[model samples]
Target: MSNKTNYSYVGMAFIILVFGIIFVPRIVDRIKNQDITRNDRMSQGQDNNFKDNSKLIFLEINGEAKKVPDFSFTDQNGKTITNKDYLGKVYVVEFFFTTCPSICPKMNKNLVDIQDAFKGNTEFGVASFSINPAHDTTEVLKEYESQHGITNPNWHLLTGKKEDIYKLSNEGFNLYTAQDDEVEGGFEHSGNFALIDKNGFIRSRVLNGNPVIYYNGIISEAEKTDEDGQEEQISMLKEDIKKLLNE
Candidate 1:
């Protein structure tokens, strides 16, 4: 009986060693190649398919999808640019001034972060229209861009007629912008970023089955919310931007 028990132990050890020798290396190789899956996330092939089926909605007006109006402006490099220039790019539009010392800083900081996320993608761009164009001339905007570490070649710090800027803000985009002496900043504008698709139509994520319209740019996603209890939507904006890019 003792001899039989010893033989059984030896057989079990041999079987275990054989299994390790035959399969352990292949298991390790699969892990090294990241070929293992835990049944939680989508597979690599489904990622693009997921983006294509996103629930992003376009802002509609008068039973038609609203499109960004035409406007011409000069960029920080003193080059002529128009809405047509952004036809094939997924872009974010914002109204701001170089001299703004309040929310504009926070808004642009978030935008710079977004630019960093898609560093090499020419399909992405930003249109920063200066509400204080008279003061935010090409030189001033160029200086501001440098000061803020703006490095994206596609980002256009635009300045044109102040009225045209205001018209685009108030009527075209419906994002408020005006000169207000009562405000901390001499000029007041929305601390919001408008996402546009490659076709120049405004795009947004659905909230309560309706378009969210604009993303709050004043708060950082890190903080979640501000001192005044305003929650940040920059994170959602980034996701929706990716969705639009995919579309």
Candidate 2:
């Protein structure tokens, strides 16, 4: 090739290399930044979905959400406990008798774990109603509390009229409680724990009355798989409490 043509080719190659050096990294950086932004948006969307799902109101009927019915009962300390006390507080509710030999022990143990998880948080608490109110008097509940080592001020073991307690269990908490001779522990009641929000509305329960229910104040499913479900529900319950507190 001629010298003039060779020099022209070399000059063109040099100019192209200069342009690539200047623009290639900027192009790559722009693409990288766009990918990061897209990922962030996707992550934010997933987080929003989780928050939305977690905040869904439970026990809705006829387009209206169900809330804890206003009632009065006596706690283990013989104090008048009512719905007013739980106003603006997030708490868990369960139905059990002190003498229960089957599920009540497990339920109470789980509750102790929950109490420990939110040990100092005033906004979180537990309300355990006795289905066997005829026998589960204030003194009896106090003994049960002592046996279980529940020293949290937020925990309340309550006893009240049998009719009132039964109605509250079935109609209010969406839990079953009845005296059955055939059932173990002389009572047939739901073993599930319920989550009530600050407004006294039940936010967690057996969805659609399904038997395969989730318990409030228990660890998450992932933790359950690893730890054989020990304290897993309490971890999930703590997460739910944080969500409500944030809201």
Best by lDDT: 1
Residue 193 CA displacement from its true place in model 1, Å: 0.7
Write the residue-wise lDDT of candidate 1 on 1-247 in tens digits.
6999999999999999897555544433332233212221111111111123455665555345679999999999999999999999999999999878888888899999999988999999999999998899999999999999799988999999989999998888777788988878788777778889999998755443233566777778788767856566777777887888877
RMSD of 1: 16.8
Please state the error at residue 194 of candidate 2 in Å: 1.1
The per-model lDDT (C-alpha) reads 0.77, 0.67
Candidate 2 C-alpha lDDT tens digits along 157-202? 9998999998887767556678999877888877667777888876
Give per-model TM-scores. 0.77, 0.68
Cα-based lDDT at residue 3, candidate 1:
95
- State, as a TM-score between 0 and 1, how close model 2 is to the true structure: 0.68
Q: Candidate 1: TM-score?
A: 0.77
Candidate 2 structure lDDT: 0.67
